[model samples]
Target: MKLTQIDKVYGKKHVLKNVTLEFPAGKITVMVGPSGSGKSTILRSLNLLVTPESGQYDFNGHQIDFSQKLSSKEKLAIRRETGMVFQDYNLFPHKTVLNNVIEGPTQVLKMGRKQASELARELLAKVGMADYGDVYPNELSGGQAQRVAIARALAMKPQYLLLDEPTSALDPELELSVLKVLLQLAHEKQSMVLITHNMAFAKQIADKIVFIEEGQVIYDGGPEEFFSADNPNGRIKNFIASMTMENLR
Candidate 1:
């Protein structure tokens, strides 16, 4: 997926400024930055959840001019190729885990119930949630619920998975559990675009890193240089130091 010169605004506040980036197939691209730096907007824009005000979005040669309003059919087509997992698990409270996972396939994809359930079960096992199929979202730990969320996304057979701080609400132990699941997916070559503040996790999983600040791309490069002490940007170095200190505390 590619975005060129994308710009977005809410009222008078410019949320994204001429943002251009690429998400390579079968590689993990991590977006790391301070809070309110437009990382979420960038992630949401990939699925057309947040409509940009200008520029182009190209997904597999389907070019979208953001200045023009997107038809529902266009949005659905983009979304069909991508699945988003948010910081909150956002599971259906009244649905069983199996039901929650199957909803998208049955409703959106129009797969038969039996076929959707079979696919859902396989994805649930893939994400280490096989035993939780009968469980409700409220009954599980944050980590388990997040895993179920992952399974639900996977069940949709998305070509690209977009995650926005999927583990941010968990404790350290629970966070690691969710991170482990993501690491496994990365090993399996699932194309992913993730927005995260955990610098260490980003380094461990990123093939490319896009550091955003003030609604602009501060740096777009590999993790080795982005995490190195020799980084030339003073503000970025300071940001790293501050994040490190926060982790320590």
Candidate 2:
């Protein structure tokens, strides 16, 4: 997927300023930056949850103009191609884990109940949540809930998985379970765009890293180059160092 000259504004604040980015197929691209830097906004734009004020969004063979109002068909097409996972596990509290996972498939994709159940169970097992299929969202720990959320997103078989701080809501110990599932997904070559503050975790699994600040991309490169002296931008180095300091404290 590719985005070019994307721009967004919220009142007096210009959140995304002429942002351009590319996510290569079957790779993990991690977005990192300070809070309110528009990292999440970019992810939201990709999922069409927040349309850009003006720009081009390209996915598969579709090149959508954000400058114009998209038809309902166009919005649905973009959503069908991308799956989004949020910081909070937006599960139906009344539904069992399995039910939550299968809902999209049965409702949106029009899959039969048996098939959707089968697929949901398979995904649950993949995320190490098989045993919790009968459990309610409120009964599971934060980590387990997020794992189920991941499984739910995967049920759609989207072309690109977009995540906004999937581990941010969890404690340090709980973060591991969700990160492990993400690592497994990375190993399986699932194309993804992740917005995260966990720099260490991001460095571990990212195939490419994009650093943004104050609504503009400052650095875009491989992990090795991003961490090494090859990165001529001193700002990223300082940012990483500051994050490291915070982690130590």
Candidate 3:
């Protein structure tokens, strides 16, 4: 996906300002920034969850005209191609883990119940939660809940996955489990735009790192370039320092 001159605002507050970047297809790209820096806003805009005031978003060779209003059906179609995994595991409280994973395909995509169940089982196994299919979200730990959320998103077979701080809510041991799943997905070449504070994971899995500050991208480059002290951008250095402190803490 390619974004150009993207702008977004809430009343008088501009959350994103004329941001431009390209996400390489079939590769993991991580976006890092402090809170309220527009990192999540950028991801939400791609799926039209947050409409941009002005911008061009091109996906798979089709340019999205922000100025033109799309019908509900059209917007749903775009969202179907992009699945978002939220920081909070947004599972239905009444649904079992298996049902949560299968709900989207069976409802939205109109897949047969049996087919959806089979697919859900496969994805649950992929995320190392095969045995928890019958459990409810509340019965699982935060990491396991997030794994089910990932499986739920994958049920739609999205071309692009947007992950917002996938590990933020987990304990350290649980965080490792979730990150391991993500690393496996990265190796499988899933196209993803991840908003993360984990610099180590970004360095290991991301093809490119985009650093946003106060609604603007201050640095976009390979992980090597981003970590090198020879880089002249003070903003990047400061960002790295903050990230390091967060990790150390």
Candidates' TM-scores? Answer: 0.97, 0.97, 0.96
- CA lDDT for candidate 3: 0.90
Q: Model 1 — TM-score against the truth?
A: 0.97
Worst-scoring 10-residue span by lDDT in model 2: 240-249
Those runs of model 3 whose alpha carbons end farther than 4 Å from true positions after fitting are: 246-249
Report the Cα lDDT for residue 238, model 2.
81
User: Candidate 2 regions off by >4 Å?
Assistant: 246-249
Candidate 1 ranges with C-alpha deviation above 4 Å: 246-249
Q: Rank the candidates by lDDT, best first.
A: 1, 2, 3
lDDT per residue as tens, model 2, 182-235: 999999999999988887898899999999999999988899988785577788
lDDT for 223 in candidate 2 is: 94
Q: How well is each residue in 1-249 modelled by candidate 3, as lDDT tens digits?
A: 999999999999999999999999899999998889999999998888999988888887567778778678767887888989999989998999999999999889999999999999999999999999889888999999999999999999999999999899888899899999999999899999999988888888889999998999988889889878877887787778788784365
Q: After superposition, how far is residue 48 of candidate 1 from its true place, in Å?
A: 0.7
Evaluate all candidate structures by whole-model CA lDDT and list the values in order.
0.93, 0.93, 0.90
| Deviation in Å, model 1, residue 109 alpha carbon | 0.9
